[model samples]
Target chain A: MDRDQANYLFNVMRLDQGASVTLFNGRDGAWRAEVAERGKRGGALQVAEQTAPQRNPPDLWLLFAPIKKARTDFIVEKAAEMGASRILPVQTEFTNSERIRQDRLQAHAIEAAEQCGGTFVPEVADLARLDRLLSDWPEERQLMFCDEALFDRPSPLTNGDATSSGTGTPWAILIGPEGGFSDAERSRLHALPFAHPVSLGPRILRADTAAVAAMTLWQDRLGDWTAPNSDPVR
Target chain B: MDRDQANYLFNVMRLDQGASVTLFNGRDGAWRAEVAERGKRGGALQVAEQTAPQRNPPDLWLLFAPIKKARTDFIVEKAAEMGASRILPVQTEFTNSERIRQDRLQAHAIEAAEQCGGTFVPEVADLARLDRLLSDWPEERQLMFCDEALFDRPSPLTNGDATSSGTGTPWAILIGPEGGFSDAERSRLHALPFAHPVSLGPRILRADTAAVAAMTLWQDRLGDWTAPNSDPVR
Candidate 1:
């Protein structure tokens, strides 16, 4: 531990000398570390053996257009907590913001992981153009397109066996801006063979709420929530 | 619309004279109103015929212990947007905050309804003691209690005809504070015939994220999201 971390652990968290704390990196497994020294600014930690094996989050990626700063932060934080493997900020036609603070969003994701006791932290990608992304879309990955207009219509998504394919198939959840997808964008997305237009519900959910609801539904049906991982300890 | 609303619409939203806007009062349904006069301080609108009938939100209620100010506001707003009919703030043993701004939280709910184009606004109830509330619990209402410690365990909840009883049976989702429910509280809740202890997912979620996730999962499995309403429009 460095000076700032030592100060935080000793002062902020009120951990004393010989206090054991759990630590994890996105690559390494979770470990138990004990405080070796108690100092005003700097301290040392004795690293112990791994407590839990490294576990990757779901292969699901969340692609969303950035909205206001707070709401965008909320989306990133919630997506990370909800087990999204990666988060991509896409610039759509109706996207209000043209730029995003990638570092800040990544930090928010990290904070969310820390708060949620998640071992894996999802990577926050830099802003990318939606058209270019769609043009170079991967053939193997299926996109779960969240359509705002589809809420008014009947829910075409039946919960029968959407996740029967298991966790091997790559997946992505796409959420549009507050203004929603334009006619051209909606049509192109709907026409795509890999894109599956899903309705969240009958209500008109805000962009942030839609992102969470979509993630929850996807996790429940198609993600890893139903199947518990084997030989893993919390 | 009043003077403040006029200033907001004309100045903030940049709506000009003769602009058409939708209005809803929860009782009269949604109506198309046109600006009759535009002034610097005030404006007038001519209310047209109702465009959509009044639609009541789901009978599902959300009971959560109040946390931080912004997060509490977020819970209320999301509960309203996610089709919660009633919002109740319950005080648990580990609840950090003892008091809450009910009016402010209610206003947040209203603003959320307005932003999400929701015709029905959820009523935010005053802070109630959890034990007292549970003492007089309704017989027909089913409570979905979100247990943090159960995330690592198997999900005992089954979707098989759980909501088949239909909308006549009331339902509520309970989310604890960041500290989570006490062992005594969890035992009591699990022992209740009406309360069903459900796990959200594998990951540990923040209180606010837990609220949204619980609402989403319940809505998908056992709420009105599975069965759309008839006749009434958004």
Candidate 2:
């Protein structure tokens, strides 16, 4: 975070010099900061001692099919804010893009990280083929698949025993595109022993809404649901 | 509802005459529609008898402090898709907008209704003062207030009693703006007996995220969670 960056943030917030702000290095934890030196063009930040320790993020991956640009950015940003460990863009049969602007999407993720006070920026992987991604999948990791096809099944959250893995193995959520998954994709997903097809209720959800709902459900079931009295930011 | 309207929809969808589309009148439920005739500019639709009866919408109301124009539209759209019966915009101590473009927002809600195959469009209410809104609040309606003040409380979905008032009653979820609620607003919210101070979990969620999360929680607990096995447009 440089002076120009500080100024940009301050301008967005309409804050003046000497105003206290928080900063996190994703390694050293959060810090209490203030406008150290103000100038016409920019200002510097005075980072004080750490306010919160480096907390570990949950091993949650958000695997979603790429939609439109704005929506893709939205999914990435929300995924970061929701504490996803990795954001993977899977190219499905219905995925619209062959040429994704990875840098722009990555920048949006970074900005979301900066705004939401996340210590770790989710690793945004380049677009990968869904078939290849599934074929070489890590068997140990649990897949909480948000299957549009399974509206009758109860929410994955309700099945407490399903998430009882003692090792706390990594978990990921898969959300399909507007047209949803082809029969082949669904069949492959169903065949996987580790894949859990969870219902987001009866009404069809847009891909973006499904992503948020699935994250909320998972957080309630296994992630840190409780908030600390005071924010741990450095 | 008529031929001209059918043509407009067809134009947007790039459909030719006799192309099938879905129509829902809210009262008679949804219907199977087709472009019966196409003119030089517009087209006509022939709507068959109801396909699905008018399903009941939830009593949930989404009351949010409005943000940017486009995002506000997005909120209204998502709220409609998520099954809110009404959408209210309130002005808080920190609320930025004193005047809201009601008709434009209403249009957005209508379009959302059309897109999601929802028969009923959520009512978008005019801007109201937060204090006054609370003062005149209905006693029977439970307020799931998303309280930033209580960082310790788990997310509303996790903290809420799933069995409480299984009977569906009028309820509303309150979301603050980017700056969040002022101390005065927080105190007023805390003092209300009808207000249930709830969290959206450990990670700080943006206003839009909170809205979606709250709706999902309510829908999971009390609203219709049945998967739409039959066509949504009845």
Candidate 3:
């Protein structure tokens, strides 16, 4: 253990030898560990039995145009808490921030996982141009394009499992920036067969709010929403 | 117009006497008004044509127990944006904050409406005891009770309009505090006929996320999600 971690586990938390603690290794599952050694600057935890099996979110990826810093962080945190498998920051024509701190965002995802007791932490990808992403889009993965132009329509996305081939295909949801999608980009997305346009509701949600609401709709309709309980959206 | 309004319009925004602007009064519609008189601390506007009708969200109310300061603010803002007609903060057994600034939360609702370009601003009600609110609960209105204990269950709520009495019945969504509902409270709620317990999936969504998620679900099933686009969820 690092010095700060040692202090937290030993000095601050006041743990004695053989104290039990839970730990996750960012892959599948969590484990119960025991305090094996205690020191001023270091400590060791002995791995015990598994507490939770590896649980991951659906094959879902959130692709959004970065907005303000705090809201951007909020999107990542909420996405992580709401059960997104991966996070991607896409740069669109109307995207405000040219760059994002991938490390910091990853940290936020981890924090959200720990705070929400989620077993998995989504990987936050570095910023990528939207056009480039479209060109390199994976063939079988379906896209839920949350189009601003379709703001007031009833969502047509009813069942996620309806499209299930039983092979566990992946899905992605795209949220545009505040200024909205450029004309050219909207046309391009609309033309793609894999992209399915859907409305969130009748209110104009801010980018961050839209991200949460969109995920809710997607999860409610087609994701693991009706599955026997395995994940927590809190 | 108030002093701040006048200053914002005449000085900060640098609008002249004839500039055009839009206005919304909490009631029903928005109108385009021309600046008739510009003063240092105030200004006058001549009502022009109606830009949009006074479109209200479906009959929906969001009742939640308050959490931290920022997250409480988030619930109000999101409720307003997501088209809840009323926001009520309830005092549950586990609720931390005993009191809430109704005015500040009201302001947040108004700000959210203006930013999202909604015609109606949801009223932020003062904190009320949960039991009292439940006792006085309207007979016809249904309540979508979000239970943490059912976190892993598939939602039983499917269609909101399925129970239509052709009377435009009202509905409300309830979210518990961070620590979740007391056992007694949950049993009381589950026993009520008007109260329907629904899961927001297995993930333990924070209270704020639950509020938004519950609203989205209700809107999708029983509310106005299917009405021709009149509001925007963003």
Best by lDDT: 3
lDDT digits (tens) for residues B117-202 of candidate 3? 88999889999999999999998888889997876666547535334532256788899999999999999998998888888887
Better of 1 and 3 by DockQ: 3
Superposition error at A148 for model 2 (Å): 1.2
Off by over 4 Å in 1: A1-16, A38-41, A152-164, A230-234, B1-19, B36-44, B152-161, B230-234
For model 3, what TM-score does chain A reach?
0.90
The 10-residue segment of model 1 chain B with minimum total lDDT is B153-162
Write model 2 residue lDDT over A6-124, tens digit each, in one string. Answer: 56766666567788887876677788888787666667778877777766457788999988888888999889888788889999998887767778888787788778766677778
Error of 2 at B204 (Å): 1.7
What's the chain B TM-score of candidate 3?
Answer: 0.91
Task: Note the residue pairs that clash in candidate 2.
Answer: A30-A233, A30-A234, A31-A234, A202-B226, A202-B227, A202-B228, B3-B44, B30-B234, B51-B234, B52-B234
Query: What's the ranking of the predictions by TM-score, best on top?
Result: 3, 1, 2
* DockQ comparisons of all candidates to the true complex: 0.58, 0.52, 0.66
| Candidate 2 ranges beyond 4 A from true positions | A1-22, A33-46, A227-234, B1-17, B40-43, B155-162, B226-234
TM-score of 1: 0.91
Overall lDDT per candidate, in order of appearance: 0.83, 0.78, 0.84
Candidate 2: residue B23 Cα off by (Å): 1.5
RMSD to native for every prediction? 3.2, 3.9, 3.3
TM-score of predicted chain B versus true chain B for each candidate: 0.88, 0.85, 0.91
Query: In model 1, which residue pairs have backbone atoms overlapping below 3 Å?
Result: none
Tell me the TM-score of model 2. 0.88
